[model samples]
Target: DVILKCDAYDGFTSNNSDENDNVGNPSLQYDIGINKCWKAVGPAHKQRYLEYTDEHISVKDDPIKTSVKGNNTSNAPKVEQTNNNHPSIVAGKQLSQIQTSLFQSLPFARYLNLITSLGQPLGHHSQTRRFRPGL
Candidate 1:
């Protein structure tokens, strides 16, 4: 039996309309993957059942094979590959679709404001600097 576990974290914000936008701060997304298999023993002391766990494999490089916007192949010319990479292509398309949806639904302006605030000075006193009182 083989077992594998993977975890990932992601954060993002959009700068668009305030309505239907995620407020408070950038949202965090977490995902986990597990792969395993187990064998069951029957009441008679014999092996009866075999269970195979789901597995998720990730492709580090470009996964899309079709020329579509937001896809890995969006910028490359269509060419024939000597080997088949359909699984990767399908995964890439799904990932790209999810990212596109998230981006499209983000509130652009407020998100930009959050980013800008990070660089600005903090504290209430920072907003007011005492100039020459007599001037």
Candidate 2:
């Protein structure tokens, strides 16, 4: 009985070895062969191609092709005219009574340290000191 050690087995070919063995080994070979499946598919793909954008045959570009844009403008939720403000929410139910201090949810404003804030834990926007670059 004989046992091949380490990489020796890889180098030693046996009767059971693959005929395409070298094709899979990067050190032995790389260019397996020109993919001829494209030959029959090329013309068919070109036929359905969009003018400049993607076409029906998206395989060469994307393994899975899809035509749907999940949340595109067409399917997006419509904007509701509630008490919407640029920097804060409304303290009251209507836009006419907009006030940040009482109604503001300032988490995002505080986290990003934007230029404004209305509530606690004080967030980042409340800082007025800018040019000091230190204080």
Tell me the tens digit of each residue's lDDT in model 2 across 50-130.
111112233234322212223223422122121222111111112212224433555544654454443335433321110
Per-residue lDDT of 1-135 in model 1, one digit per residue for the tens?
Answer: 011111111112233553457444443211101111111112323323222212322232323223322344444322222122333233333444544554434454347557886533332211111111111
Number of colliding residue pairs in each model:
7, 1
Provide the lowest-lDDT 10-residue window in model 1: 1-10
Model 1 CA lDDT for position 36? 18
Off by over 4 Å in 2: 1-73, 83-88, 91-135
What is the Cα-based lDDT of residue 128 in candidate 1? 10
- The residue pairs found clashing in candidate 2 are 110-124
